[model samples]
Target: MTTILVPYHQDERLLDDEIPVSADITVRSQVPDGDAWQRMAGVCSATAAAVSPVVAAGGIPVVLSGDCMVAGGTVAGVQRAGVNPAVVWFDAHGDVHTLQTSTSGYLGGLSLRLLNGAHPDRYADAIGLRPVPAERTVLVDARDLDPAEVEYLAVSATRRIPVSEVSADTVPSGPLVLHIDVDVIDSGEVPGLRFPVPNGPSTDAVLAACGRLFATDRVVAFDVACPWSRTDDEGQRNIRTQLLSRLAALAHPG
Candidate 1:
């Protein structure tokens, strides 16, 4: 059976409702404050530990909670099983900042750098997983980028595809880990995100892209980030719910 591991804490009510089948749901509510990187790391480490056994047994796809920073632990779990997974990072921001350059100092913003070998001591050494090769990483739907992140993208070998270019033809040549940051969706669609950006991909466009990606058969696991559903805007919540349902359907199509 497949498993959807919910590794979040702040807004449990958003995902408390029933999810689709084709998954054995596992919820880990160890949410850390946005300012606490160590706490976040600990939670992710624990979540990885809990899910590692099942992954070792094989044939299960783990859908972790929507926190981009937790990518470290997910990568650790995949690496422990001896898999080199390609990454499809879907988000508005590149998330390639180091702690030193980050204006917000949000751990989520620094996740991609950790995945791609920036802060070796905190991420690579602590997690016991090497950074994924730049060639194997793909950043999609990115628009709001930091200056440092932009410089990194210009030189890095990771494939960076703008939201406008994500079509059915995009394909990864190896095992894949798909990460979606809801902020990639336009603020009009999901206004609840802490960092909502303007002029992102439409909901249907993103879902279509995800559908094509899932059809590739190379995807081994999926992770989503920053899907806040409790904002004051009811329309945004509706959009979020619809998007989640679409993702669940893609993961469990019958």
Candidate 2:
């Protein structure tokens, strides 16, 4: 499998060497200040277009982005490639909201719900993305959620596995897109994150879960949301090394 590296800077200028390996494609945004929701929509659409060709050629996109919302575009790209891959969302936030449900009005927060086809969003429809069934979708380690988000999940069919229960077997079948929100790791253990939640899983635990998922040989795409790369990168380097090594392993046959 040919794996392409993509760094989604989300506007911050980070060099390739800052990460453990160089990226084949570097994605940066320069949208004028406007509606946050619209900006997010724009990113998803652009992400879909950028990776569509790679997906069509059967190359896996190893994307490093800033926010959980990027999954929408990742799903769109996979659809464009002729596969409706399931999404395994790993985030500290529920990310399953509607425009009405979100109190903070963070556009990316409702990414999962949006992808589930709850909207009349012109951009999503324009990108030709389909929704993943709740039964096929999994949201892992969302230790933090708003009241509305909690209420939505209570009645929703989406299967959720806490950090403690995440395992190779817990994830839905392969030909899957696995999204890892770096903030899902304990804030104390990790840094340079935009949002940090307490009492989350350890880095080792997250890596173990990822290992199990990758070992299944079912994962079709991977996303690591690293919104910011801080100057002090001792912690970041450790994470970068582990993730790159794991991705490299995925590319080569066992």
Residue-level lDDT for 253 in candidate 2? 42
Error of 2 at 248 (Å): 6.0
The reply for model 1, stretches above 4 Å from the true place, is 7-35, 57-62, 167-171, 227-236
* Cα lDDT of model 2 by residue, 123-217, tens digit: 46744678788877899988898898888788888888886676667766658888887777888776666677889888778767776777777
lDDT of 1 at 80: 74
Count backbone overlaps in model 1. 2
Q: Give the count of colliding residue pairs in each prediction.
A: 2, 3
In lDDT terms, how accurate is model 2?
0.71
Clashing pairs in 2: 66-227, 174-218, 175-218
